[model samples]
Target: MHPLNDIFVQSAAIFLELATSEFMRYILAAAGLHLLLSTLLKPLVRRRKIRPAWPPKGQVRREILASIRSVLVFSMLSLGAVWAVKAGWTQVYREADAHGWFYFGISVLVLIVGHDTWFYWVHRLLHDKRLYQGWHHLHHRSFNPTPFTAFAFNTGEAFLHGLFTPLLILVLPVSYLALFVFSVHMIVRNTVGHCGVELFPATRGGRPLLGWLTTVTHHDLHHASPGWNYGLYFTFWDRLMKTEHPDYLKHFSAAVRAEPMKRAKPVALSIAIAASVFCAAVLSGSGRAEATETAALETISGRWVTEGYGAVVRLQPCDKAPMELCGRLDWIWDPASGSYLGMEMLSGFRLQGAEWRDGEITIPGKNQVFRSTIKVLDHNTLKVRGCALVVCRKQTWRRLESLPHIGLR
Candidate 1:
């Protein structure tokens, strides 16, 4: 094949892979979370009998089709990314240590702020009378948005929005890990914005330092009435441009204050007890070797203190991918530290032979991942070893029954 033809072929291949991967990521993160939250809060929705109903009929199907198209557009943008990186047109660095940790940290902050600005302006442009019908109407169709609405942009809008990362890399030197983190943050915030529930605490949304941040109510209102709140990831632009809805706080308060199911607490408690009993019975009835293996598996599934005591992570079975184990950061020891709670620290682990292998462990603050292995050492201790190339480090973590309170008296 001709050289240019070869590039096209490669880009096409890249597009397909990226499209499939992005679709899975979006669906799993958005739809899975939507299902979990909707199911868990079904009783609350029922009791409150809110208007516009949870997930209007035919809305999910339309959202899915629109999202599929958007993912394709995003994949085309990814093709541009691949070509740019190959042609030496981008400043994306592979080594996290290339510019040191300080530069890496600053670059991530810059990337986020830059993207927020870009999104705000582009979003406002999409809402223009001339462009709204052609470019953004598909997304606005979801008058009562759900998490699936997060990626349900028209092809033109998706292409425009997806250009941010590719363009950012052309001008700014960012570590690959930083780019990955930014992408994850974008999806999570986007999903939460369209989740149709106000997950933020009622008080936090009213505080001076935090009140400026946008919430679900802020974005949902924009979906309900499309002339304002065009910012993404933050409220800086909306507040500065005076586009924020006046009654945002009031709507948020009412949404959060809606009555929860009276029986939810007792139902949750009963389920927890039943699960505990089932697990205990299975372990107690097994033979010696079988019981030991079961105990090890159970031991691995709980709160654990990380090696450096920097964070506490909970290891649990991934509900979407049941064959694999996942670990998420639950808390950090340093209250002043940057927020990393709820981020996945370990993922894709599967048991092979006597040990849990084929997993990747992310070292928070370091922006690095290592091929990792976990071995249950008795019932209280776990041996975790991570290797980068040939250099390897092993850490012993103790299982914690619960997180420790670290605040000052």
Candidate 2:
């Protein structure tokens, strides 16, 4: 594992261990709020005498099969998770005691990607022309689905869709608790999306406002058009795959149809930004300033290398100010980092338009990278140098004029 990463994981584990009490209390508080919402708010909907029509009987078979497939796949995924943990897949996950956090994260990420792959395939299959006429067409019967409609699927379609995660786990190694959390989050999100209840977008207690679940309008539209809005939890797949309804905006309720789903706000923002940039460029005479390539970035323009406990740095254009104007280091090898620690040198430093102007000299090292400058110091010699901290050292060059013309050209 990377040293910085290792330290970060260890620190997080310690923090969690130390704050277990606070963590539990926070969990308890969340649970309490959920309980209150279920007992109070949900019942209000029932008392309001609102009920939605269930999907056709044919659609019912899909949900039943989906649930079964979901269970089977999860059991297999458990085995995969165990195997990954035992394998010590990476240095990050090698130290089991210290790296459980990353291990868990890895497992969940694998599960999600796996699920997406499978869901995409299965969903595509369900939409296939041949299958839609027979096995998959029934689910599309609903014109406006309520909460009950979310699970409305053909048995075969549901099985294919829901089996993704478990099948993925068969090939992966995931933490059991992590899997559990992932499952719960997925189910809750799916169900709440289908719940058909528009929530207050304002913050309840300075937290996410209506972010806990997909809005009622989001799912209700799906039910209205079976081929569209098939995704659960997130909207990415539907939009990305072009499976979303074409008239979703036109038919959308005013409450939910605020400006045609906005087309993922960022697109407009990006275009606006681009247009603004273009206009700015036009205003500023094409926004292109005449530039001469005299150096790389200032931070990287100098020399660099990693040595023992401490490093050595040298600065050039050697003014009285003792910082890394430029310099170079000898050479070193970092066995752990698997990187070469080498020296660098440079000269003729000055502020160039938006960048530092200077010449660079580099000395490549084994298992390490190096850099420097070539100013054609003299015809008989060349400047050689390296750096550890800042500029390590600098010496006037005395070689065959320019380069073998090998890399220098």
Candidate 3:
């Protein structure tokens, strides 16, 4: 067989394995949680008569169909993960001790936090008027969601959501077990958020400590009113941005107050199990940290389009100094205006903590350099900011796999 054919065959096999496994995981998680909460638990826990019945009329069937479509789309996207793992582009490790138990816990936390951040931004983006009708309107169809609505996403929306996992794995070192745990955590939280009942206790002003955490009511409000409550796992972004629904507290209080006191044992047991798992993850043994070459710079190497789509820059390793980062203008929207192609745009960047700072970016039209910082929002997005004294300009650039045809405007 040809070398390319051999590689293709191997990738196909990996994709099949990953897709099948992921599909099963989605079905089991969504279905099992739905059955447990909507069918079994809700009936047992009701203390008083609620105005609206659970599951609502006709919502379950729509949710089921939509979720099935989402599963297929997600399964297809899992191929990207398989390719990354096989090509050694991902930081996935088979050995649990490769990065130590402590690092494993940290990695899991990072994945969750990273995922929440990504979801919040992307979710908000999808709500944009230009994108909402095509990308996100299908999801809002389920005004009163059941558990099945947890995974019910439009194909475009599904692809965006599915892309997060593969992108995260590419940039971060994660173990197989840690990824599995993250998957479980994702599904459980997703199911509870859409479960249509408040499983958390009511607090005075929603409890200061728990306020940062999203509850079932938080996402439920998002469905009820699409503009507010755009968080998936954490409420930090919504709270900070003041996008949370105004009546969120009143709704949460009503839901919590309705829970029957007689069924407290089951809810308590569930919380206890979750707490134990968290404790175990944190208190696990520490091992020797792995000493490996940092690929932090390589993770950000790619072609990026400027925010206004004004210019395209290709980022690569500096030839003269391998440790330094450099970018050159590859294309300009208006070539007749003054071709900047091959002109250096970025240089002198080094990794500083979570961001790549102490860099300089040349202003395209004006022959001037300004202090700049670059941070990888994800595998396909870079946040670049340039500061000139008190005046600053920021742009979120999207990665391009290949350069496009540039013509004079």
Candidate 4:
């Protein structure tokens, strides 16, 4: 046997061992937390459920399967750290006292804070319209995520997240203990954040320390509305960016209070309750009620002629997701394009304030879709924007009712 071959074989074995160890650690942490919170302690955790509704069937299974792939990607990347350590390339040290007790402790804290900073920026990057479908969509698939959804990342996302440890070790000196603690803390908080349960009580208004850190509700709201709450361990970055959801505190308070049938309030009492709520809102000088009313009243459901009046699309409540809007091609100016009629042109348009967001719109003559948002400009006009990657284009859609001469197209 050749000497080079012997080195290669040994290196491969070490990589495999490291990969297996990392994979099992993830499985144990994710599954153990799921069983503990979602099954064994359901009665308790259910009281602080962030969202009253449960995830749809098969969601958990899908999450776990997708997570397995992510674990492999993570494991493979971790091997790079091991190799770096052997090559004397990274600051990773094994001895506890090598860095002194004080430095050891500080290193652990630094890793936590550094990882948080890394996560905030990387997460925001993943949400770029060009990268979302390829990198972030898998994680967001679990709108009502569970513990199993913690590492359910797309391959691109897994690679980016997995790169953290290797890159960190290369620049920052850390002990093995610090790395272990960081890994454990990261996965635990991640699973809990996705568990769809708020484990912390509401903090006092403007409370210090506790108010600054993120709770389960913070990350869960990110899953519910991806445009906000991009921070991982703390609210500092999101708040600094002015990207934290405005209703975050209100949602946190509601989750902790555990109002029974919160999302399913009886219709009989709705009007009376709504009246009282409206009065309280007005007295408090809050404009949220008016915004809600506007969202509900501005129906974008109707046939509209696309820009250039080249096509007509019918917007309606999606059959598969009744709460969201879907659009289908109703007609096109070109008679030969009849085959495109009845084809879905837009989907997954959820109401967010006065705009419909996080939707996909198909581009003509292409087999792809891009991120889209629609806003009602008036009773007869709509503002439609589509984005592919970093570039965005806008279009104005006029109601089909305004076009009286359809026969002369």
The reply for model 3, stretches above 4 Å from the true place, is: 1-9, 38-40, 43-45, 48-51, 56-58, 204-209, 258-267, 270-409
TM-score of each: 0.61, 0.39, 0.61, 0.61
Clashing pairs in 1: none
Go through the candidates in order and give each one's C-alpha lDDT.
0.72, 0.42, 0.72, 0.75
Tell me the lDDT of candidate 2: 0.42
Tens digit per residue, CA lDDT, model 1, 1-409: 2434434544565677678767876776676556545565455444322134666799989998999999998888888786688578999876776899999889888988888899899998998899999999999889888878989998889989999999889999988779866766677678768877665434433322257667777788899879878887788899899998887767766765532446435444543443343333323322343455455556579888877676778898765554467899887777655477788899967664467765789876676787777888867678998776655678988777533453311
Model 1 poorest 10 in a row by lDDT: 278-287
| Model 1 quality (TM-score) | 0.61
Query: How do the residues 37-154 of candidate 3 rate in per-residue lDDT, one tens digit apiece?
Result: 5344555346311226665587777877787788777777777776667568988876666878999999999989989999999999999999999999988887877767887788
Q: Is candidate 2 or candidate 4 better by lDDT?
A: 4
Deviation in Å, model 3, residue 169 alpha carbon = 2.1
How well is each residue in 254-348 modelled by candidate 2, as lDDT tens digits? 33223232432533354344334323322232112212232322223332222221232344433332222555443234354224243443443
Measured by TM-score, how close is model 3 to the native structure?
0.61
Candidate 1: residue 218 lDDT (0-100) = 79
